[model samples]
Target: MNKRKYEMTSRADAAARTADRIIDAMLARFATTPYENVRIEDVAADAGVTGQTLIRRFGSKAALMNATVARELARVAAAREEAAQASPTDTIHELIHHYERYGALILKTYSEAPLVAGLPALAARGRAFHVDWCRRAFPLDPSLSPTEKAVRTAQIIAICDATTWRILRFDGELDEAQTEQALAALLLPLLV
Candidate 1:
């Protein structure tokens, strides 16, 4: 019975590892490739698994994408929590680092939300994460009215958003350091 139980545990652990590999491969593909261009066979090849294995693990392409989004959100949440413990400037640096790493994936997910089955909820969750981060990173004045605080929060979200990062990094052709500087210049003033 003990040996049987050990084998069962090992199998479960291996299965979990395989699933994680699939999700990681999907995320890696998402970073450079557009959502529409990402094929399940390619993701499976990248993960060192069969296409059928991906389907068995995630049920469908949409489900795989959804799982990837869920995993990415969980990672972002943990990183945000750790960053929240630091000084505000340090936190901004962390945010910039995250944007530099994940901005393309975030932008692709948002743009494909309507066309993709499960991406709308992912996009909404991303927005919620940004809003919560802004609220925690920039505390409202006790003297301010609720409406004023809400407006300020909205402004902060806009300034620190993925779209803003995309515009600076891609459209403006700024490097990560320059983008971070631009963001800090715009946000630090409002935060104070």
Candidate 2:
């Protein structure tokens, strides 16, 4: 790569690492405390950065939360891709397993806090990516049309997005395995 390109890539990598640290710290906090109780200063302290530094890097608390949500979704997408390559038919299982691992904080933050209420655009984009992921990850049945596949992908994603997980886990009192079983039930028809 060219010098300027290399420089930009390195800077981007550094920024991503910093953001990852912040997200990890935030997740640790969210696991024990409610999102409303956690402040930006607390997040900064947990991440080993100054509040000002976090503001400079992530702008506002909303922005930081959005960035963290986006990062987790990206990680999910990456994991899904890797798992899909190995077991296309079982990619939903991999996705559910991944969710069981890193999805708690995401489900809590977006659901309980108003900080992420302003992230509709980001959420929409994430949904679009999810539809594509579902289409690719799930093995296509010979009986399904392309249009049917597209619609089913969108529907499944709409029902099982981050928000859904929060609702199911909190409101419905469904544990991780229950959530996975429900999703697998909905997804199995598509795979067949």
Per-residue lDDT tens digits for candidate 2, residues 36-128, read 676889999999888998899888877776776777778767887787676643665677677667666555544564546656666666657
Per-residue error at 63 for model 1, in Å? 0.6
lDDT of 2 at 34: 72
Q: Where in model 1 is the C-alpha error above 4 Å?
A: none
Superposed Cα deviation of residue 18, candidate 1 (Å): 0.8
* Candidate 1 residue pairs that clash: none
TM-score of 1: 0.92
Cα lDDT computed for each candidate against the true fold: 0.86, 0.71
In candidate 2, residue 116 scores what lDDT? 62
Estimate, for each residue in 99-135, the C-alpha lDDT of model 1 and write its tens digit.
8878877787888878779789888987888888888
